[model samples]
Target chain A: MLDHITQTTLLLDEEKCRQNIAMMADKAARNHIRLRPHFKTHQSVQVGEWFREQGATGITVSSLKMARYFAANGWTDILVAIPVNIREMELVNELAAKVQLHLVAVNIETVQALAEALQRPVNIWLKIDTGYHRTGILPHSHEELDAIVALVEQNDMLQFTGVLAHDGHTYKQTDAEAIRTIHHTTVFLLNLVRDRYKGRFPELKVSIGDTPSCSILQTITGVDEIRPGNYVFYDLTQQHIGSCNFNQIAVCMACPIIAKHPERNEIIVHGGSVHFSKDSLMGANGSLIFGRVVELSENGWSEPLEGIEVVSLSQEHGTIRASKALFDRYKIGDLMGVLPVHSCLTADVMGSYTTLDGKRLEHLSGMGQL
Target chain B: MLDHITQTTLLLDEEKCRQNIAMMADKAARNHIRLRPHFKTHQSVQVGEWFREQGATGITVSSLKMARYFAANGWTDILVAIPVNIREMELVNELAAKVQLHLVAVNIETVQALAEALQRPVNIWLKIDTGYHRTGILPHSHEELDAIVALVEQNDMLQFTGVLAHDGHTYKQTDAEAIRTIHHTTVFLLNLVRDRYKGRFPELKVSIGDTPSCSILQTITGVDEIRPGNYVFYDLTQQHIGSCNFNQIAVCMACPIIAKHPERNEIIVHGGSVHFSKDSLMGANGSLIFGRVVELSENGWSEPLEGIEVVSLSQEHGTIRASKALFDRYKIGDLMGVLPVHSCLTADVMGSYTTLDGKRLEHLSGMGQL
Candidate 1:
């Protein structure tokens, strides 16, 4: 695989990815929770089939475009996790007619617009703000919540399904106990909202997701559905947040060495911000690290090298600060595997991937005009 | 145009872009230096035509793939600015056979590999390190320099063109004087290297490039050609570096408003890392700013909003902390124009563009299987 790479290529380890899927699936099965994993991480139809084999019947995406792509490829059920944009009502109507389209709303105006514009039935999930503060209405804002729910109930095309919240604050925690605490608090808050509406809507469910909380917690208590996405291809940020071990990382960028500066113990590779998005994590020494370096082998890659790290990235160049030993071991034209800091962003940037067995996988972004 | 955008769309102001091109071309003409603008910023064939109208006949790209994209579109003289990756010799041979391919080298091993692998003649430029210290041999390293030059001299397929250096260190400065100082020092050092081999290679040329220096310096001395790319799409980063004014910025992302948070004074838009990228600038209050917000008009976007700025970004959402006036001026479903921090990365991530006149411009990445 290394010999065949002529440029920066995203390499996927299928065995490890499957193991991650099975592990998350088994956890959801043991807790009797529906595992509607988010498809935004991999965004590959071939990888989505693996989830179907593991009994995942529904999926979550971040945009209407992505949901439409998955729907065209035979995915019948999808939950768009972001707040619905009313301007895309034509697309919304088209998708609603084709699949079990689940849309999210945090404001009454959007609900009113959807009620007026929809030509087909769709499930509406109230995007509640648990604590992330990025988007969503506060769970305790009953006036606003009741208005949106009442509008949804009045519309024949809109069905009030449940409440969903993404505890994205888990990404800021580096301790397992802290992640668990945040997860428990989020579930408790989400249950409060569900309990408030149980008298009117008895079958209302709770959906929550975030890789850190999902990967560290032993069991999910209150949520009826889990939508963890990044666990499928956990990255260096996940490792730093204590979500997954280094060996569980499923993707690595194969970048060819383009230049070497032994005097400064720096190696330049063809990978850069274009290949790996500019997401970063603080290193052990308090410096910024773009990615972790690994040695590539025939089957896959080894563990992260001890003292080698990607320090900076330009548009098409990555400067890796390496230890003397590692710098001497590699030369120009050799391939080095770099575990990205954020797998979802990296996969989105690369647009396609090649498996270790030399099979090519397609992504939605790579398919133009989708 | 605003009504036509259903999702995040990159908006290009063609008038501003062409004016930027003409301004730089005029500066190069006045200084008696050739203008081989970098094509990596816009990566559009139509935009390259604008440069051709401005009398630019040569171009520079960051990768072999990009060079091929332009070469197929009738760009005959192309330079791949990064150090040559020997693993891509097949692409090198293909490009060398098609156009006046110019490749850069920092070491002897790559030159030796090029000497052995080439079936066509190619111009080789010795990439020198004046001060940027990213990837290049120091200009004072005479022994290493002489070795690579002598090897290039011995190979019939190699034509030693000259010395090329990118003073990327200019990007770190926020003052015009500091940028000019760095530009002068870089030119002095590049001239010293050119003078060292002047007797042997009498026609050797010197080249230097960086948008901040190229835009701010009053006079350029001792360089045969200038290659600044980002000036074509001056971004918020260039404005912060004192390179170009805010009005000269040619591109802005048109993102639809999805959610609004009145309590926190935050507006969530359908733009994030996947659209605008994660490159940031330090804000006035010491917070990291992903991009600057502007009002979208029918003609084009307004100047940067005084107190509204993008504070945080996720995979598909941008959280903007807005002033009370700006927050109340818009609502969900309205469009906001965001000037990106780094236009090159943003353009590469967006993959396509929509001009103010509603014409769609294609990008190389958007054309799959390049």
Candidate 2:
């Protein structure tokens, strides 16, 4: 193996990562809520240990592979964030047998399907659509909830744990007040359902997610647990929405400039969509830059550089057009640090992470999904 | 291990891949020229092996990692198509020692940098910018050529092998005549310098590359070799430019539809920028879909069903929006085959390959440039 590697690899600052974890854990502690931070952002076992150390026992994952990966590495509490598919019941049963696996049910049909397919008991959280028109049951759909509750009662293995709402729309908030409004509406809907079900079912769990809410909100009343994955590696998108400071961004992929074209004012980078991710988070100037152009140092994730736009990206090549008029900005032999538009995607493609101080850490230990 | 594993992997038809190789090889053979297909598109040993099987001796790669990957995989004659950087002299030396590596030098500075760095003799190909202004030495720069030639004569290790040009602008060609025009202009520029130094340097080589001209044009006169990589995996872009027909397209990454929103006429897929690559190829209705969603069968890549466009892509998820007319056409759980606008970037992400018949193959053997 080559000893001195020059290729710009994904550098993880363990200290910064732990600090981000501590901040989230502290936030949850202050709010008196359970902190089941999403592990999908940093799928490394080494990175996960940081959260596990900071008093986080439960975690969220996007897929079955991630659930299995973490469970094998001693993470007993794993929540498969997507709506549970009846097709994956066998794997879910196997995973639940190994540990405490919580899942989401967005539709009554899927709840019925899960009831019919599951041979063992599985904790199921009913997903409510507060505002994000992406996934989950509509908040006004009383008929749908009644049907799902009816289906859950029929199956001994199926348990309705709580009403889960992922306020993903909060990330699109333009201002703090917009985010605040999203949280207010989210909490209001949960309380409306919680009050109705309290006398009949006092064990109902109310869980809220979405990094922007979990990161910015000082308190989360009526919510039992908060799952925010991207807090560990805050990105440009998070920064735009004022979720976390630029200094708190923990993980960044180091990319090298392969070719610098002065005529077009563009520089081709080795890190492309495959590595840096094709996430378009444009700025006020209408300049397109999917990920932030950061600087690298001996210690950890560096400060963000201005007047640099990652204008366009090909598969394995990123095309950055310098906004700076100075020609001495970058050359063929320079390495640029990139903070992604969203850390969730950035951390996913890298597969593994190493510290800025040259500490190689194995992170692909227990991914809920691969 | 599971009895059978299925994932969203690149499906490269070995037969078609070889056929493309043979077609290009035959074109070179008829013209009494050399064939050098660029390996940047399908960075696979198996694909390279197929090229070799079809009589390809020289292959082009964009990065040192790719050059190393192909060199280690038994490709004796390889060309690193990217311009030489002074910082990567050590890697160039190691690569030059391993094989008959042909490095591209765009200017007097790069050529001079190469001579001073490499202790051993390295075959240098002078990259000329005839039109598409990305990289390469200006075609009409006599001062630059004089400086390059002066250094080459002084330093024996800096041997001038050939003049190479990439007619990527041919991709924008509208008709068969436009392709011929691009071919004529490209050959005109390569011939311009070759004739200038014909008697001065008898052993100088001349080559022009781009899949559009190599795949379409029947003639190769002044040009001595070809390095068209995208021809192997014909994309929608190629099909649009009339470079290759849809039937000739070999690779397709089959993505899974995880969620279907019938009201919105949108289907969320498992493949995103991480799988299908973020390339914009125009759809049938003039809408820009990142890729063409095809009709996938249990057997192989098939004809694309009408009106399935991958409207948007996130890191791990692609939002394929079909027309309301198409919603009733495709089912909820059906797999959709997406044709990448750029095949190379899409293939590199999954780090592996699959066949039309759903067989697995590994492509990424080691780390690429940072």
- The DockQ leader among the candidates is 1
Please report the candidate that would top TM-score against the real structure.
1
Pick out the ten consecutive residues of candidate 1 chain A with the lowest summed lDDT. A361-370
TM-score of each: 0.99, 0.89
Report lDDT (CA) for all predictions.
0.92, 0.74
lDDT of 2: 0.74
Model 1 Cα shift for residue B319 (angstroms): 0.4
Q: Name the runs in model 2 displaced over 4 angstroms.
A: A1-5, A85-90, A190-201, A260-268, A290-295, A300-302, A323-326, A329-332, A362-370, B1-9, B85-88, B107-113, B170-183, B282-287, B323-334, B365-370
DockQ metric for all predictions: 0.73, 0.28
CAPRI class of candidate 1? medium
Which predicted model would earn the best lDDT? 1
Error of 1 at A339 (Å): 0.7
Worst 10 residues of 2 chain B by lDDT: B1-10
Poorest lDDT segment (10 consecutive residues) of candidate 2 chain A: A361-370
lDDT of 2 at B221: 84
